[model samples]
Target: MLASVAAGLASTALGGAASAEGGGVPALQLITLTGPGTSGGDTGPGELLARQDAVLAKVGNPTTTYRWTTALNGFAVELTPEQVAVVESDPEVASVEANSVRPMSARRTPVPSSAQVRQPRATGGAGVVIGLVDSGLAPESPLFAGVPGLGRGPKDFAGSCEVGEDWPATTCNRKVVASGWWVAGFGPERIRSSEHLSPRDAVGHGTQVASVAAGNAGVSVRMRGRTIGEFGGIAPQARIAPYKACWGAPDPRDDGCATADLVSAIDRATADGVDVLDLAVAGPPGTDTVERALLGAAEADIVVVAAAGNDGREEYAAHGSPWVTTVGASLGSVWQGRVSVVGGPTLTGASRSRRTSPPTRLVLGADAAAPGATRRHAAQCRPGSLDAAATAGRAVYCERGGIGRIDKSEAVALADGVAMVLGNVRPGPVVDDFHAVPTVQLSAPDAQRLTRWVRSHDRTSIRMSGVAPSPVAGRTAAWSPSGDPRSSVIKPDVVAVGDGVLGAVPDQRGWAMFGGTSAAAARVAGAAALLRSRHDWRAPVVRSVLATTAVPLGTESVLRQGGGRAGADVRGARLALVVRTPRYREVLESGSWGDLNQSSVLVRATGSVTRRVTNLGSRAEYFSAQAIGFTRHRVRVTPLAARLSPGETATFRITVTGPSTPGHVDDGWIRWRGARGSVTRVPVAITR
Candidate 1:
C-alpha cells in the first residue's frame, strides 16, 4: 500500500510529510474535518480552512491549506508532526484519514425495453439532467448529435461545459450539455496519449455507461467495417452532464475511481443541478464518503442510482443504502448459445461455437498430456504448465476455479488445442461469456460425468447448436450475486438486460458489449430519467414504482432479482402492492444487520399486520397474497383470494404465527400475485 510520508516532528515549525521524490520539502496531504453539527452550519470551506490556518500559525506552520467543501468539508495541507498533533487534539476535528488510493469496484440492467416502452416523446426528459461521474465519454458519437425535434435540450437547464484535446469545444451540444474533470494532482506519467486536461474519456467505461443511460436512438454499430446493428440508450432525449472523476491509473492502462476524486466530482455534479445521478461504481462494505454524498443527493431531491458490485457474495451484498436504488447484473436469454456432447450425457451450455474456429480432435486433457507434469497441474490448464507436443491438435478439458476461464482458454489455444472444455470445480450455473477461443464450461456434475467417460476409454464427440435458441437463457447468469436471507433489506431493487448488451463506444465507428451491475445501473438510470420527465412523483415514489413494477425471472432469488426487470413507463403497472410500514425503511435505535438497522413490527402471540392492495388495471383483476421463500419462523398470509375492481383498494392482514426460532430476527415479505401475472413484495420483520 502506498503511504504518506510522516516526518520532522522534533521542532515546532511544521515540516510536514516529505515526498520520496521531491527533496526535503513537505508534500500535500488530505485532511478531513467536521464541526459539532452546529458550528458546521454556514461554515463554508474557506472559513473552515481559515480557522485551521489560524490554529497552525499559532502552534507551528503558518502556511495556508487548500480547502474543499463540496464532497464534505475537508482540506489538504503539509503540516509538521507538532502541528498535526495540535490539530488532532482539537475538539472540532472529528477524524482525519490519509487519502489512500482505492481501486474501481467494476461490474447491468434492462427493465425498460421489456416493459413495451418505446422511445421518448418531446416531453421525454424535457427538463431532466442525468449526470454521470465516470471515465471515457466520447462526444463525437452520433448518439449525442440528437434527432431533429427531440435533441434540443430543456429550456431551464443550469450547467456549462469543457473540452479536451481531441474533443472540440463546440462538441458540447444541447444533448451532452455539460462536461468537467477532477484531476487530483495527476502528473504526466498517468496521462493517456489521447487525454488532455479536459474531461474526455481515455478509458471506455464512462462512455459506455453514459450511452446506455442517455444517448439517442438509431446509433449505428460497426465492427471491421461491417455494420453489426444499431443501438441506443433508454432515454435518448435526456440531457447529459459528464464529470470525469476517475482517471487512468499511473500505468495508463488501469484506472482508479478514487474516493477523494469521486467526492469532489459529486460535489460538482450536485452543484450542476442534475435531476438524476448515475454512477456504476461502489467500494468495499461501509458507510463512507460516497454514501454521505448519495444521502445528500437524495435529500436534495436528486435520485441516485448505483451498482451493487461484482463480488457475487450472498452475505454483504453490496450497496446497502435504501436512498440509492442498487442494481445487480443478469443475462438476457439471447446471451446463450447451445453446446452439447454427442454419444455422452446430455449437456447444455453456451459458447461462441466451434463452427467458427479451426477443428481439432476431442480428448480429456489428462489423456493427451505428456509424461512429466502432475495430473493437477494439467487439469488446472495453466498456460506453459501443460506439455504442448502431447496436447497439440486436441480439445483440452480444463477444470475451472484455479484460474480465469479466459486464461485457461488462452493457455489451451497457445498449447495448440483446438478448443477448450472448462468445467466448474463447484456447483454453479452455466455462465456464458465470449472467450478468445471457442470454449464452453460445464457444471461440476456434468464435468465429472465427462471425466469418468474419458478415463473409461469411451468415445466422446462434442456438438454445437450453432444458432442460439429464442427461449429464456438457462437461468440468470450463474455469477449474478444473490442476497443472503439474514438481512431484512430487499437488495438489488431490480435486475436488467446485462448480458452481452451491445452499445456504441468511442474510436469512430466502434461498438462494444458490456455486462455486470454497471450496465444494469445505466439502463435503469435512463428509464428513471424517462419516468421523471413524464411524472410528478418524488424520488421515493419513483423508486417504489421501479422496484414493484419490475418483472422477474421465476426461481431466481427475490433478493437478487428484486421486483425483477424494470419497465420503461411505470404507469403501465396493472396491480399495485402498498404497505404503510415496510420494516426495511424504518429507522431503529439498537439492533442492526450489516449497515441496516432493524425496526420491524413486534410479533404478538399471533403476528399480523394490515396491507392495502389497489387495482391499477383498467379492468377487474384477481389477486392473492402469500409469503414466499423460507423463513426461520414460518410466515403466513391470509386472503388467498383478493378480487378488486379498477380504482378499488382493500386491506389484508398478514400474521406470523410460529414461535421465534434460533435466529434473533424473523424477516419475510408479503408477496402479492394477480391472475394478470402481476407480482410484487413488501418486506416484513418481527423481533422477539
Candidate 2:
C-alpha cells in the first residue's frame, strides 16, 4: 500500500508538474483544533472559522476549502510541507493529518427474507432522514421518485440542493430531500469531463448505494430491456440527504473519496440533522479525522453505518470506530441461469441478465486468442485479446480476475461474441453484475467442467435459460473482510445481504447488480433508520438492538459475522461492557474495544468480563442467561436469572479459565431468554 501511494504521488507530480512552491508538493490536510466543546463553552461556526483563520494566517493562508464546525472542530485546507509544519506547531491545533483517498466499495435475506416484509411493520422509516456520504445520486432514476404519500420533507433537514445550468432545481424532491457535492479536496482540475459538478452520479456508485438505503418502494428493476422484479429500499419512505464526497478518476486507484471531502461531508451531514449516516466508502479503522467526525456525529444522536470492506478476510476490517455500526457483506441465493452444454450435463450459474439467445457454438477464449496475445490473457478475455473471427458467432468462455467483470463482458461484446460464460478462479460467492451481453457466472467447479468439455468435444453448442435455483443461500460473502484482530471489539457488528443487490444506476442503464460491504452497510443503514423512526431510540440503543436481535446466518466464526445478520425487529437486552474510563472530554473515550457499549464482547484468554444489560421495554421482564459454543475453556455466567422493571439495568460476569495456547481462539454467544418470548444474544470472543 505504501509503495502504491508513492507511485501515485510520483505519477501526480509528473502529470501536474508540481514542485516545491512552499517547500514541498501541494497536499491537502485536515487541521484539528481546540474549539467548542473541547474545553467548556460552546463555540459557534463563526468563532470556529475565526479560530481556523487565525491559525491559517500564521502559515500565509494556504487555500482553505472546507470548514468543519459541527461534527469536527477543524477545517480542511491545501498546504505545502512548510505551511503544515507551522500549523502543527500552533497551540490551538490538536493534530494535522495529510488527506488521503479511499475507494467506494447488498441485497436480500438474513435481515428478514426481504426488506419488503419489514417495511409495513416499521412504517417504512417515516419521518427519518438518512444521510449518504458517497459518490453522488442519479436524480433521474425512478427509485428517487417522490411517492404520493411521502408527504413533506423533514422540517429539521438543513441540507440544500445546488442548482446549475445542467442540474436543474427540481433534482431534489420529497424522496431526495437534500443533495450536495464536494470536489475541492479532489482538486477541481482533476475532475473528469464524465464527472458532474452537481450532486449527480456519473460513476453510478452513489446511485446504487442510495437505492439500497432509501429508494422508493416497488420500483421495477430493469437491465438491458429485461424486467427482473420489483424491489425497494428497506426504509422506502425515509428522506435522503445525499452528500457526494467520492469521485471517479481515470486511474482505478485515484477513484476514491478524499479524506478532506469525507470529513466535510460528515460534518455537514451531522449539521443537517440526519437521523442516520450511511458511509459506504472503505477506510482505515484508526481514529483519524473521519473517525473523529463520525464520533461527533454519534454524540449528536445520529446513527452512523459503515462498510467493513471488500478486501476479503485476509485484511483487517475498516471503520472500526466503536460508535459506528460497521456491517459486513453476506451473499444469499441469487437468481441463476441454467446452461445446457449439448450432449453434456446441464449446470447453473449466477446471472441477472435473462435474455434468451439461440444455441450458439462454444468457443474457448484460448482458441480465439488474437495473434501475440498470451493464452492466459485470452482466457481472462483481456480487451483486444480475442480474434473477431473466432469469437464473432460463439459463446465465449472467459475467466474471472485480472480485470473488471463488466470490462470482460465488454471485451466479448467488442469481439462480437453472442454470449459470455464467466467463471470464477475459485469456489466462492458468484456475483451478478450488469453486463454488455447475456452473461452467466459459474463457480470454480462448474467452470472447470465446462472448460474441459469445451476443449475436448467437437461441435459443442450451448443453450441458456434464466430459470435456475441458486447454489448457495445466505452465507458470508467471499470478499467481505473479517474483524480487525488488533482491536478486541469484534468488528462488522452484523452481516447483511450484499451480493447480487439490484439498484439504480445513472443514464439509461436504469439498474445494475452491486456487491460489496458497501451495499451491506446501506442495508444496515436503512434498517437503523427504520428502528430509529419506529422507536425514536438513540444511536447506541439502535445499534444494540440490531446486534442482539440479529439471527445467526450459519456456523461462521464471530470475527466474520460478528452478531450475525442484521435484524429489523428489536427483541434483545442492551448490553454494554462495564468499562472504568474517564468522562468523555471533547472526543469519545478511545479505550479498550471491550469497553465499548455494544452487544458483542471480546476477552483475552483466562479473563473475566462484566457487562451491563438494560430492558428497553415498558413492562417488567425476567431473563435467563446461557453460554453456548465455548470449548477448551470453562465459562460461567453469574446470576443466571434477572428480573428487572422497565428501563432497569443489571450486571453479569462472564468468567473464563483455560490453558492459553498461542494463536488459539474461542467464541460463543451469551444468550438471554426473556419470559415474553423475546431473546437477546451477544457474541463473545476469547483470544490468546
Candidate 3:
C-alpha cells in the first residue's frame, strides 16, 4: 500500500503539560541590559553595587550581573521586555534590547512513504560506504559483517583515554590525536585515548542508528530483546564508516564542537569514497554553517541525508536546505489504531491530585484530538473534560512534557479507566504509549474541538475513516525534524520504517527496537547501496531518481508527499528500450535541461540484437520505438543508473527504430524523455 502525508498535531490544554520542563514553560533566555555610564569607568566594587541598586529600583528587582570582561565591558542586567522598557526609559539607561534569547530547537516533519521508495527490486548496492556521525559506535555490529573493502576503523573526534568499550575518562592519550571533546560540566575538553581504541558507543544512540543503516537481517545479537526490546535496522546489508562527533553527556550545552567537526566528517566521508552519508544530529535552526557543509557534500555528489530533529515543531532550516534529504518521525503501528484519554476527571489544585474513574467506551477518530478543557489547578473535571471523556472509554489526551508522555500514558492505562493517551504539541498529536492499550495522538486544535463538543452536548462522538494502522507517507515521526512554514521548504523528504526497528547494539547483543529518523535514514542508505551495486550513479542523481519515482500519500497534495514514497523496484530500475528517428528526438528534447535524460529503446526479444543504446547524459532521457514480430519481455540491464553519474555508461535494452523505408534508408535515433531530453543517432544497417 502507498503511504499518505498529513499534519500530525497534538491536542490538549495549555500549561505545564505543553511545556518542556519547569512547570511546562520553555527555557527563558537571559537578556543582558546596559545603561549609559555602565561601561565608562573602572568603578570600584562599592560604585558597582550602588549602580546595581539603582538599576534594580528602576526595573523592579531585575537580575544583576557583576562579572565584567573585555568582551562585555558594561554592567549587565537580565530582564524581560517589559522590564527592559522600564529600564530604558530611566534617565540613566543608555540602550536595551535582547542580548540573548532562548530560540526554538530544530524540528522536522516526516515525508510520506511515497517519498521513501518507489518500487521493490533486488539491485546491487549491498556493499557501499555509509558514514555515521554521532556518538561513539560499537565496532562489532552485525551490520558491518562481510562488507567488502571496508576501510580503517572509526576515528574519535573527542579525545578520551579509556579506549576499548569504556565510558569517557579524565586521563589524556598523547598518542591519540584529539579532534574535539565535550566534558560533563565544562565545554570542549581535550581527549586523550590510544591503544587501538575501538569505537565504543556508551550512549547506544549511534550504534542503534548504524544498525538501522546496515544491520544484517534476522541476525539476533541480543540485549533488550524480550519484554519491551527487540532489534533490527533498515538496511541489513550495507557497511558503515563511523565518525564520533557527539561526546560528553547528552546535554547540548556541554557539547560545543560546533560545525567544524561536522564539516571535517563530510570531507572524510568523501575522501573515503563512501556511497551514502547519514547525519542523525541537528543544530539550531537558521544556522548557515551546517547548511553550507551539507551543500558542499551534495555538490561533491555524496548523497547527504540528515535527521529532521525530534523537536515537535517545524523542520529546521539547516535540514531544509535543498541539498540534503531531511527525515521526520511517525508513530509505529503499536499506537496508531488505539484510543486514549485523560485517565480521570479534572480536579482543582496545584498538585495533580485526582481520583480514578471507571473505564469508558472507545471512540474512533484520527490519531490526533481536538483541544479543549484548560487545566485549572492540577485536577478538575469540567463538563467536557478529557479525563471525563476517557473514563467513558474514549481515548485520553495529554500534552508534550519533558518526561516522555509514553510512560505517562502507560501509567494512566494501568489505572484501569483510560484506554490510550494522545500527545498534543506544536507539530501535532503523537501516540505516547504507557501500556498495551491502543493509543492515537491528535493536534491541539483538534483536541480542543473535541473537548468543546463534549462540553456543549453531554456526550461527544468522533468517527475516523481512511487508512488506520497503516503507515503514513511524509508524516514526520516524533523524532524527525519539522519544516518551517515561513521558509516554505518541506524537510525530511521522506520517512522509512524505523520504529521498533531491530538491529545490533554493543556487546554482540542483537535485535533492539529503535526509533528515530537515524534508523529510517539508514534504511534508505542501504537501499541506495543496493542501487549503487547495480548501476553507478552520483549521490544527487540517485536522490533525484528516488524522489521522482516516489508515490504520493494521504489526501493532501504533492507538497505533503514531496514526490512520493521510496520503493525498491528492480523492474522500474531497468532502462526502457525505444527506437526513434530525428523527428521523435525533436519532440522529446523540447524541455528544460538537467544532469540526466531518459530514452525508450526497442529491440527484437528473439532476434540477433547484441547491442543497445545507453544514456550518458546528465538528464533523464527516454526513447520510444516499434518492432515487427517482436514481443516485450523483461531483461536484465547492466550497470543500473544508481551506480552511474554523468559521463558514465550503462547498457540499456535494444529496440527496433522503425519500419524499413526503402528510398530514405531508415535510421534510428534515441530520444530523451522524463525530466529532460536529448537525441542521438545510432548507425543501423536494415535489409528488407
Candidate 4:
C-alpha cells in the first residue's frame, strides 16, 4: 500500500480576484512579425536569418526590436505598440497584439510544520547547482552569505552596466545585445538603493519564492515563520544563480522581461551547468517561446519545475514539459482560523469583528449568519439568493465552481448586508482564502443545513467556532498539474508544501508569503539535490526514482497529484541500479599452444563491486543467456536461470560450447529483455 498525506483542508467558497487594481498598468497589444516556414525546404540557420532580416526590415527601427520564436517556423519579432500598427500594414506581417504579459501573484500554499510527519534527513545538495532565472540576485543578502563554490557573480544578460545593489532600481541596458533583448511590460525600472539589479520585490513574491527552494529558513529572519515561512525549502545547502527577467515597476516603458531575454537566460543556465531550474512564470497555453525554453531545458537534462498557476480557473495553461514538475497548493493548519457569527432575537445593533479562536466542539444550526458559510463558485449559489443573502446581513452558501472566490467576496461586500459566506463542503476539510472578510467554508452537509435554515425562517441566528490545528502529514494540495489526458505519462511527478510559504524578500528586513506549484517545484528540486548528494545519479535516474517512489495521494486517478509523495528513497533508487551494472569487461588468456587445435584454461573475473541498495529497492532481478556459433550451436550452463536481489547473492555459470573451425570462441550472454540490468555480452576465449 502507498503512503500519502491526506488532502489538506478544502478552500472556502469565495470568489477569485485579480491583482489589486492600480498597481501596474494592464498589458497592451504590440506589433507582431512572422518568419519563414520551418519545414524541410527552409530548415537551417541561414533560412532563419534571412527570414529575421526580412521581418526586421519591414518593421523599421523605432524604440526597440524584440525577437521571439514560434514552436515551428522561424523567428517572430515583437515591436512597440506604435510599431504594431505599422508592422500590420506591411505585407509580410502575420499578427499583432499587446505583449503577452501577466501579473505575478501568490498561488502555492505553505505546509504547516504539524503536517510534516517525517523530516527528511539533511542530504548534501551543496554540489548541485540551481539557477534562479528571475530579475537578479543580491550578493549581500543573508540568503547568499558565506555560501561556498558560488558559480560566478550574476552576469548581465540584459547587458546593463550600471548594476544596482538593491531591488526595482536595478536597470538593464536595452541596446539589443547579441543574445538578450528588452521588450515592454510592467514592474520596476530604475535600480533601487540596494545593490541587487533584480526588480524591486515590492510585491515581495519572487524573493519569497527563491528562498523557498534554496534559502535556509530562520537564517533570514525578515521572512517570518509562517508554516510557509523560514522552515520551508527542500535543499538548504544548494547554491542559487539568479537571472533578472521581470521588473516590478509601474512604468509601461520599463517593466517586464522580453522573450529574447528569457531564452538567453535558459542558454546561460544550461551553459553554466545548473542542476535545477525553477520558473515561477506563466503565459498563454499554446506553443510559445516560453514553452520552448522549458522544452530546451528538458533536452539539456536539467530538471525544470514550474507553477501550475493560482487563478482558481482550470482553463489556464500550465508550465508544462516532460522534464518540468508542476506543483499545486493545499491547506495548512497554521493558516486555518475559525470564525463565529452570532445573531439572536434579543440582539440589536450588534457589530461583530472577525476573530481567531481555539478549536472547540462547535455545534451546527446554532446561528444563521455563521462564519463558515460561503462557497468558492458563484454558480453554486441558489439563483438570485447570493445577492439577497449579501444584502440582508444573512450568511451565503454557494457550491464550488469555475468562477473565482474573490469575485464572490467582492459581490458580497457590495451587497452591504451579508455577514459572511460559506463554501460547499468536500470530503476533506476546507480552507479559507487570503481575504479579510468574515468568510467560512463548511462541509457539504453543513452547507445544506444553513441553506435549509435560512429558507425555513425569516429571522434566523447562527454561531460557529472551531480551531483547526495542523496535521502530522502535509495535506496533498490539488494545484499540481497532472499528466496529459491523452497520455498517462505523469506530468507532475511529485508534490510538496507550497501554500502560505514564507521566505526572503527584496529588502533586507522584509519577508513575504508565497504559494503555488512554483514553490513546490523548487522543493522537489532541492529534494533531488539531496538524492544526488547521497548517490551518483543523473537527471533521468533521479527523475525515475522520484516518480516510482512517490506515495499515492489517494485512489483518485487525477493527474495533478501524480505518482504521489516525494522522498529520498524515490530519488535515489534508479541511479543505484545503473551503478550496479557492469559497464566494462576485461578478458585474460591462460596458455598459448602452437599445434593444439583447442585449449582449456581457467577463467576468473576482477572488478569493483558496489552494493548500496536500500530496502525500497531490494526486489528480485532476473537474468538470461544465449550463445551463438559458426553453425547455430547451443551452449549449456550450470545455472540455467536464477533470481538475485541486489547485493545478496552471486551465482556462477559455466557454458560448454559446440564449435567448428579454429578462429575464436565467443560465449554470448543475454539477459531478460526488459529487466533492469539486462545485457548482452561476448566472452572471448581464443584457441591455439
Q: Weakest 10 consecutive residues, lDDT, candidate 3?
A: 1-10
Range of the 10 consecutive residues with the lowest summed lDDT in candidate 4: 1-10
| lDDT tens per residue, model 3, 247-344 | 53344343322243344445445444456678776656642434444544554456777765555445442375545666554433422332223342
lDDT of 4 at 111: 35
lDDT score for candidate 3 against the true structure: 0.40
Question: Any runs in candidate 3 off by more than 4 Å, and if so which?
Answer: 1-124, 141-198, 221-232, 250-257, 284-287, 312-317, 335-469, 472-474, 478-490, 497-514, 557-561, 567-571, 574-688
Question: Would you list the C-alpha lDDT of every candidate in the order shown?
Answer: 0.61, 0.76, 0.40, 0.42
Predicted model with the maximum TM-score: 2
lDDT of 2 by residue, 619-653 (tens): 88888999999887888899898997877789888
**How close is every model to the real structure, measured as TM-score?**
0.66, 0.78, 0.44, 0.50
The sequence of per-residue lDDT tens digits that candidate 4 reaches over residues 177-263 is 111112223212342333233333443555566566666424524212223213434665665656545554544333345454455
RMSD each, Å: 8.9, 7.7, 20.8, 18.5
lDDT of 1 by residue, 314-431 (tens): 4344666666777777666533343455555656565544354333456766555556766776788776767778667767888886776667777787888777877887987555
Error of 1 at 344 (Å): 17
- lDDT of model 3 at position 30: 20
Best-to-worst order by lDDT is 2, 1, 4, 3
